[model samples]
Target: MQDMSASLEQSKPADSPRDGHLKRTLENRHIQLISIGGAIGTGLFMGSGKVIALSGTSILLVYAILGFFVFFVMRAMGELLLSDLRFKSFADIVAHYLGPRAGFVLSWSYWLSWSVAVVGDVVVVAGFFQYWYADVPAWIPAFLTLFVLLGLNMLAVRIFGEVEFWFGIIKIVAIVLLIITAAVMIATAYVSPNGVVASLANVVAPGAVLPHGISGFFAGFQIAVFSFAGTELIGTTAAEAKNPHRSLPKAINTIPLRILLFYILALVCIISVVSWAEVPANRSPFVELFLLAGFPAAAGMLNFVVLTSAASSANSGVYSGCRMLFGLAERRNAPAIFARLSALSVPVYSLLFSGVCMLTGLTLLFIIPEVMTVFTLISTISAILVIFTWSMILAAYLAYRKRNPAAHQASTFKLPGGVPMAVTSLVFLGFVLVLLALEPDTRMALCVMPLWFVFLLLAYRRRTA
Candidate 1:
């Protein structure tokens, strides 16, 4: 590992081109909010309804189980990143411990994952816009959003951080308000128009937990996996994060708690207010909860919240895609143009390339007029790619320990259970893959994912040649 790391270090020129390095302008608060934004994905807002409809009360267990494994994934990522500040991203760590080929594939895979996910997010945002302006063209909002985010991202890294910070704040406030309102309704025994009484009993009713049986319980993993797609995004921010040793660990350590509060507790509140059986699979449960509470304008208000949530997710996606492209360029895995930073230290060409890729969202919207269908398809592909990305992180971690025993021993933020936990996480991810095969929608994506790897293999070989 040491020799490989040294060779990798030696490969890059000691002197970089002017403004080649990314700026470390992202502060502790920015990292905190970005972490929150990554944790509370747009899937929780848009996809949770379907998860509840499928898994019933068992959705809680679904989030809990996925959250447990995801937390460990983040921890493993945190340790690997902090072990060396020279590691700008997990791809860098993978290249050092796994090999340049693994790094190349992982970087491009992660870039594709975010790129695909952003397409879904932009599609959803357009749908949210249509909720208010029923006659407006869907492509309008989608295009405007991409253009604005691209402009913000082009200015500087801090602007991107600020945008995500406020976006994260909006999502947090929305979830908290929903939880509180639900608690008040449950305490008052408010009865909905459907004659269902708001009570904690609704969440714990007999047969409620597995209303659709174990198949439904297992079925929840597909979108639930997509919901956790960006949980490891903070790993990509290592290059631009200020005080990474302090901020990265702090941000990652809170992931489990964030999942508990934002996902598990929030779902419990929603389920208690509206029976899991009544949760609309096609609509957001957040908006449903407010509408049940007699808020006539709940749809529009929650629509705005979810719109921003989706925008936040897309924004993060663009930023991550740009960084991954930039990283790939630095390693000579991609065109050198993407490695050139702007005067403000942002990767200008990389940002432009990502924005262009996201334009495919508009084309998808036109082809697939149904928003949910497009979202489900895109999200499944994103989830498959995410699973591959996380698996590589664990695989890289295991190799890091085997090759750098001394570094592992000296690390302050070591992944608990070490090799065993890493193995267990890998097994859990594999099980999720099997679950993906059970549903026709996700199964198609699972089957198609190999083509991406085949393409990557060809690209890697060509790069090596």
Candidate 2:
């Protein structure tokens, strides 16, 4: 009877195959938009001001350098996924090469990373609402976003894909328009109320290139690494991608170009329009620069875009967290409940779990109104956890290469400098962790980060033993 019961449970279908977790509903266009959308987060829209203040003109170089390194990391990841169609994302690949123990760590850590990130994005959404109405509490928007996303995710993965597609489209259009506006102002040599004009001096001028010198440049590197945090989400969704082998490569190739045009060019335009020293760390210089340049309408429009960008991050946060949880359950690392799916083929349990966690943002706003610090702390911790996952991928790649030299020799999507580039990328990430500790405020992340791992280790020991 016990054996029969076990057989029945094993055969039970939690979700209909048709309605189940995204089965290639994401086409090439959907994949590209999602990749672009994930890459362009609230960080670029909101956090760029602080990064600019920290590194001055050198921040651009920091992004460029970091972008260069992460590109190789993505290439290595892409090569692994293409090597085996069964490999969904980093977690699956880690599990395959390392062990179930490592996979659990990667999966849970990744889920927590995205879950924590939702807090930051949710808080930002609340703040954006405050700009329109002073009395409205932050929790309202946070809670509303949480419920809205919950409903959307529970329906179908395709719905979530479509929403993110448009959310990302809004961001792309806004940035393109901002670039055009900056270009026109530069060509005309128009002076802003701040008495700055577009010129090459913005990048090369003294106190601009290295405002805080090497220290500031390093500081910017840490911040820029955090900004590039979600670029790997493309890999996460690869299993669900309709044609991952083709779509994955296309998405990965776009990263460096995106960084060059969106990140590098955008910053150059902003700094040229306003001095690096004058760019406020607390305020979004993008919006302020538009206002200063006698384009109040564009400023207001950009504010709307920033608001949408925050929402976009929160939306993707739920999508990513739920999927990560589903992946974990498939590997037996998470509760069976997380593996359960609705008639629509969605992992409803994991979806609701993330939604409820995001709703905590509302509780936070009421309990601790000065929640930006909490947001920053969570964001830093999430970034640290992601570095762990990335390292695991490189480690897996090293092992995979050792095991299959012939396959590596035949692969087309190979890293340029081979294993050395992978090792150097790992080392650079470690260096960023040290830099995070150097900052008094960010040091809190180091303190909280270990507690998470300790908890994971305990769980792993209990499960294994």
Error of 1 at 183 (Å): 0.6
What's the C-alpha lDDT at position 374 in model 2? 56
Clashes of each: 0, 3
**1-465: candidate 2 lDDT, tens digit per residue:** 243234223323345343344466788888898888878887787778888988898888888888898888888888888876666677777777677678888888888888877777777777667767768877787777767767887877788788889988898898888888888888888887867877757778877888777877777765576678788888888877888878999999999999998899888888888878888776667787788888788888888888888888877878888988887776667776887778767888888887777666457677677545556666687778878877888888887788767768878788778899889989987887788876776787787788888899899999879
TM-score of structure candidate 1: 0.97
Please give the lDDT score for candidate 2: 0.79
Top candidate, metric TM-score? 1
Candidate 1 achieves a global lDDT of: 0.89
In order, the Cα lDDT scores of the candidates are 0.89, 0.79
Name every residue pair that clashes in candidate 1.
none
